[model samples]
Structure formats: C-alpha cells, structure tokens
Target chain A: MARVDRSLVTHLPLFAGVKPDDLEEILREARSARYPKNSAIFEQGADAQSFFLLLHGHVRAAKTTPTGEQIVVRYVAPGETFGLATAIGLAHYPATATAVDDSIVLIWPTAAWPRLAERFPSLAANTLQTVGARLQESHTRILEMSTQQVEQRVAHALLRLAKQSGKKLDQGIEIDFPISRQDIAQMTGTTLHTVSRILSGWESQGLVESGRQRIILREPHRIVVLAERSADSGAA
Target chain B: MARVDRSLVTHLPLFAGVKPDDLEEILREARSARYPKNSAIFEQGADAQSFFLLLHGHVRAAKTTPTGEQIVVRYVAPGETFGLATAIGLAHYPATATAVDDSIVLIWPTAAWPRLAERFPSLAANTLQTVGARLQESHTRILEMSTQQVEQRVAHALLRLAKQSGKKLDQGIEIDFPISRQDIAQMTGTTLHTVSRILSGWESQGLVESGRQRIILREPHRIVVLAERSADSGAA
Candidate 1:
C-alpha cells in the first residue's frame, strides 16, 4: 500500500467539508498509484473493480462505437474523479480511461463504497455532485452536436478544453497538452480533413496557431463569436 | 400541500431501498401538483426552487441554444425524477421541462435536498445512478452523431423512444406519445426536410408507419439493422 499524505488531497473538491479525522479514514481505504503517459487505466467493458480520483496530470476518456470508430468522450483533469461505473450501477466501465501524461491517482475498491458511504455520508453526497456535473456537461455536448454547425462545435470543443486545462502564455492561452488534429476531430464529431481545413482557415484569420500536436488560441473571443454565430450567418 | 400516496412512489427507482415509514416521512415533505398538457412545468434558466418525480405523465426536457434553436435534451417518463438542480449544485435549471400530456408530479423544494439526502442515503445513491445512466446514454448519442448517417441516427432515436414508451400492438409497437417529425428531427440533429424524406423512404419500405404526430415501428428488427448499419454500408 502506498502511503498517502493528507495534504495531497486536503484542497480537492471530493474532500470538501469533510472532517479531518474522517478524511484520514477515507484516505486509508484508498491506494495511490502512478500511470505512465498513454497507459489505459481501464478499458471499456472491463470489470469495474475500482474508482479513481486523479491527484496529478490529465486523462482522456474515450468510447469505441459499434462500427469501431473512436469518440473522445471527455478529458479528466486533476482533482476530478473517474471510473465510477459501480457508483452508477454499471457492471463494467463504459469507456476507456488513458493517462494523457504521467499521472497519479487514488484508487478505492468498489466494495468499500457501501461501508464508507454508510460511515461518511458526505462521500455519497460528493460523488452525487460530481456525477451530476458530468451529466449536465453531457447534455450540453448533446445539444451542441444537435444544433450547432461543425465549426461551431469544434470551436466550443476547443474553448471547453482551454477552460479545463489551458495555460496563460506570452502569446495567448495554450491548451496545455499535446493534442493532435485527429483528437480534435474525434472530440468534435467531424473528420480529420474537415478539422484540418477549419483550423487552417482559423490560422489564416489570426484566430489560432497550430502545428503538429500544439494549439494556441490567439483570439479566443473571436472563436467564441464564431461558435455563437447564428445559423443564418453561419450558413456556407 | 396536496396528498401524496406512499404507493405512488414506493416502486420508483429513486425510492428503491427506502423503508415504508421513511417513505411516508419523505412523502410528508412533498406536495403533488398537476400540469396540463403542453404546459411549461419549468422554464430554462429559471430559479430552480424545486425537484420533482413524475407520478403520471410524460415531460419533455429541452435546451435552447445561444443562437435560439431548441434541442430536445431528453424525455422524462412517469416514475422518473427531474429538476434536480440543487443535488447537482446548480442554482438555476439548465433546461426547460414541459408536459407532453396531463401530468402529476410529487414536488419537493430544493431546500429539502440536504435534509432528505442526509436522512436517506439511498436517495443520493439512486439519484447518482439516474444521472450516471443518462450520462452514458448521452455518450452513446454523441457516438452515433459523430459516426452514423442521418438515417441511422433517426432509426436509433425512434428505437430509443419505442423502448422507453412503446405500446405493443397487433400491427407493431407504437411510440405511445404525440411526437412529430420535427421533434424527431430535433432529437436526431437533422433538418425537418431531411427527417421527412428519410421517414418517407422508410414508410415506402414498410419499415414504419408514421403519421401527423404518431409513429409505429412495423418492422422493429429491420429498423435495428439500419440503426446498426456500418458507415461503409450506409453511405448514400
């Protein structure tokens, strides 16, 4: 069992409002581990033996469709929880979680949930809050895909990524991760060619800078305007 | 403070493990109300003062995008819960919910959430399960939209509705509600014209029976095949 420092998770949302002693007890049930970059922590349809809280680095959660095409579900940031299939009543993980960078996570066996939840009610409450927020985000993504144009959806996807993990730089806000155009295409539900063309057009218009797997938003406000452009104005 | 029968909620997924007396006590904190057909139960962005469980009727939850286009988020069936902004930590409702039929719902003020959640941990657990299931469904929808053709998407949408509220009959399984093509179009992220043309083709093929505000799947198995058709085979 890896030793966990109380300070490592004192500021995280999952531990919000928890008493110090209870926090220690909760941490006792969790085992911490490291995952290398690009390693899958869990795969879709695998038995969900444990749930995790990311203590460091980023993770990508993705789903493979019946036709074998991959869809980027969402990216998990530090301090967020993932692999919660058991909490949601699923026997297996619905999507795969891969470490986007060398990451540390605190894993708790699913069996401990009932006892822990019984002893510390806040655990259930916090998990509910986390799941609720994700549910709302999923609804928003569905709405965007249903109503918005491809470019608008792509813009929204980038903005969401920037908000989640962007770093302020001298030039502009960088997405703070090595993300390829193919990843953007998967996230936006478009083809690689279409995503490349759209990013190229944005580059010429001075809205963004992109190369290889790096992206920097030169004019995020402009991207927002483009994302919110009305259907009439957005029509080709 | 309208009367709420305990049996009306005992079988619900939200109250699955709640004890009978505890259920009664929970019901005591709630009020029941009726919403007329096509009435707005709650509007999007409204102050979310209450959460509810439908006792008898269907509700449509929708989100209006920034550009003023409405996207059908999901439909709430009888015995299901909705309007839980507080549990998710939102001060305002994210979407508008409207009655599709004469409906009765047990209403609980948002202020009671913490108390109820503390008193009954199953409530929180069940709600987490509900939200998680919806999130999974949303991911499935995203995958479909990202990879499938419009026809396949439409097929999947209809099949989903049929599974949710289908009424088996001699001819076929009816959708059991007044859902128009425009609603289906909005649900599947396509234009009305495209939805109409596709449905017409399906009608001609004897795969479905669709009229003004009704749809019946004459050949559900065939529709499933179409919905699962690989992209290479579904291309026009």
Candidate 2:
C-alpha cells in the first residue's frame, strides 16, 4: 500500500492534537481500500481483523438477529470510525458494515492498536470521546423506541439522519444518501408498512417528501414538534 | 472526607493494570459518598460535574421521556463505573441515576479527566474499552427491541441481569439485585401488565419464580429456548 498524505487526515477529529510526526507514523501503517456501492465491508461474526475510518462516502452498519432478521444499527459518515471490535475487547465484528455508496476507508490491523494507542495517547482519548458520543446516540434511540410513539420515533430518526448527513436544499434538508423506508423501519423499530403509512401521512401534511430511496424534511420544525409531542397510542 | 484505602479498589476492572502508586494518586483525587436506597444520585440534565465508580450496591440509570415516562437504561453493579458524561463530551447527565440499594461511590470531578487520562494512558484505554462494551450492549438492546418478541426481550434482559449480578441457589440462579416487575417492564420496553402476564405464564410453566421486588429463574434453559425462538407474532 502507498503511503497516504498527511494532509488527507490531519483535520480529522481522530488526528486532532496528534503531532505531525505521530500522524505520519499512524498514516503509514494504514492501507486504503474502496467498496463499490452496496458491497459488504465486513460481515457480522467474522474475525474483526482491522479497524476502519471512512474517508469518503457513507456506510451502513446493520446487525442480523439470531432469527435471520436484520436491523439497521446506524450509518457511518465520512471521517467517522467503525469496525472497532478489537478496541472494545470483542474478537468478532458485532454488526455487518456495508457501503451504502461507493466508499473509501483507511484500514489498520487491530494488532497495531496497542502500539498506536501507547505512542499517541491523544488517539485513545479521541476514540474514547467518539465511542462516548455514539453510546449516547444509541441510548437516545433506545429511549425513543421505549417511550415515544411510532410517528415520533420515525420523526426522530429522520431528524438525526439530517443532522448527521443532511444536504441543505430549497425543499429543506435532503438526507444526502440513498435511504429506503425499510431502513427507517429498522431504525425506528417499526414495520416497513407502518413507516410507509406514516411517511405518506406526513407527505399529505407537507411535513416531508419521500421518494424511491430518498427523503427530504420539508418542514423540519413541524417534524420536531411531532417528535416531541406527548405519547399518543404508543409504539406501533 | 477520609481517604479511602487502596485495597478497596485494587480488584476493580477500571483499575486493572494501573500501578499501585498511580492508583493511590487516583484515589487521592476521589471522595467517597453514600447514597441511601431509592435516592437520586444525580438527575437528568444536571451539570455533569463528576464521574463515579460504584464501590458497593446497585444504581439504576433511568431516562425520563418528555411525556414523563421513565425508561430504565441499565443497572450499575458494584465495581462498575458510571456518571461519565464529561468523558463522552456531554455537559449534562443524559439519564437520572438512582441508588436502588444503599450505595457507596468514589467520585472524581470531571476537571481531573484530561490530566489523569494523559498521565495514566491505561485510564483512557480502559474507559474506551468500557464505553465500547456499553455501546455494543446498547446496540444489542436496540436489536432486541427492533427484531425480537417482548418475551424474548424480557428473557434477554433477565439473562443479562443474572449474568451481571446473580447468585447461585439450590433451585436456580437468583438475580442478586432487587428488581421489580416495573423495572423489568422499563428494561424490556413493555407495559407492566404485559410483563406481569408473561411472568405469570412462565411461573405456571416452571420457567421462573416472581414475587414483589424479586425474581428467580428456576428453569433458565427453557427461558433461553424461548428467548431464541424465532419471531413470536413479531415484537409484542
């Protein structure tokens, strides 16, 4: 693998506060790879041999239940880290990571982790902060699933996606990636038919615009109101 | 406050691999406090001024929804860490932590994290691993909520609690903590009535023994079979 330029990653939060020399050493140990759209980056239960940083495009992390059902755990955006099973003491990947779009990522063998973390204390600190943020996000979703209504849960999911990867447009903020109603269903713990019905209802109310593999929040404020509204009949 | 003895925490996972002198220094920065059972350790959205380690007793971390419903996030067992809001970059506690039993905790102000983490690299690595493990657990729960039946979810929750804090008895493993049906309801994202009905059915079938504020799994193998049973009419 060719050496990556320091300029490519000095701006990343993972590299923040790391000296240029340390960053050079870290970058040298990484090899870059690309996945075509919809290609699997890694599979659940496979040996987690490497950690990754998405340098370009988006990735989806989905967990397959024991019963053969898949749940959309979360999405990974550019400059975010994933496939950190070894860092968390797990020997196998807990979820399968797939490229939602043609994507590039920097890969480092898990064997290099201890050395890298020891040499660059900031790296561990940064990763800790990142993991912390994601834990909070997961907790937020759990709360939404447990206490909020289905429509509210869907609204929250869209809002979170928009916040994470939205592209501001005239209509509002487009999700900026190809996402289907099935993805939203798995995200919010609802069935696809129920998500479709809720989206259709929102479309009629001018709250959102949905199309094949696309979603745009036309009235984000209104959606927020719905998301925060008190429980109706409860989870769908 | 009197200084806590070093021996009190030498066996904790958080202190693993930390040198004795370093442990002493870390202990010097912490003050111990006791929380009476059923008392609030910290409220949601309060300034996250400190991080904590449970020295003795259990703590329940619950998130209260906007509509006033409380969801039990998880239970904290002795020797576990909690209140790490600042470590994750949060300015306030995300959930309210309450002592389920009279508890003693070692507290350290958030201001000490950076210096301590930098000086003791193991601290950062340990915390990263801790948060990573929790992030995986949260994802597991999310998967259960999205894909599993209510009975399965409850079974998983019980199994988890038992693993975390169970004591062996003549009949079966008893969850060592005082967990009520309502707590189980909050943990499994089901109504109290639903949890009660399921437990009653299990009791008659010799799967578990339930009582006020206590439960025992008399037939864990059968419950595991139920938990792994595929899609019972899809997520009650």
Largest TM-score belongs to which candidate?
1
| Candidate 2 local lDDT, B2-105, one digit each (tens) | 98977778988787889999999999999999999999999999999999999899999999876688889899999899999988778999999999999999
Number of the top-ranking candidate, with lDDT as the measure: 2
Chain A TM-scores, all candidates? 0.96, 0.96
Per-candidate chain B TM: 0.97, 0.96
**DockQ score for model 2:** 0.82
DockQ of 1: 0.82
Off by over 4 Å in 1: A232-236, B234-236
* True-vs-predicted CA distance for residue B178, candidate 2, Å: 2.0
Screening candidate 1 with a backbone cut-off below 3 angstroms (N, C-alpha, C), the clashing residue pairs are none
Pairs of residues clashing in candidate 2: none
Q: Per-residue lDDT tens digits of candidate 1, residues B1-236?
A: 66687766788888989998888889999998999999999999999999999988899998897668887988888899999889988999999999998999989999999999988988878888998998899899889888988999999999999999899999999998788888888898988899999999999999999899889999999999998877677433
TM-score of each: 0.97, 0.95
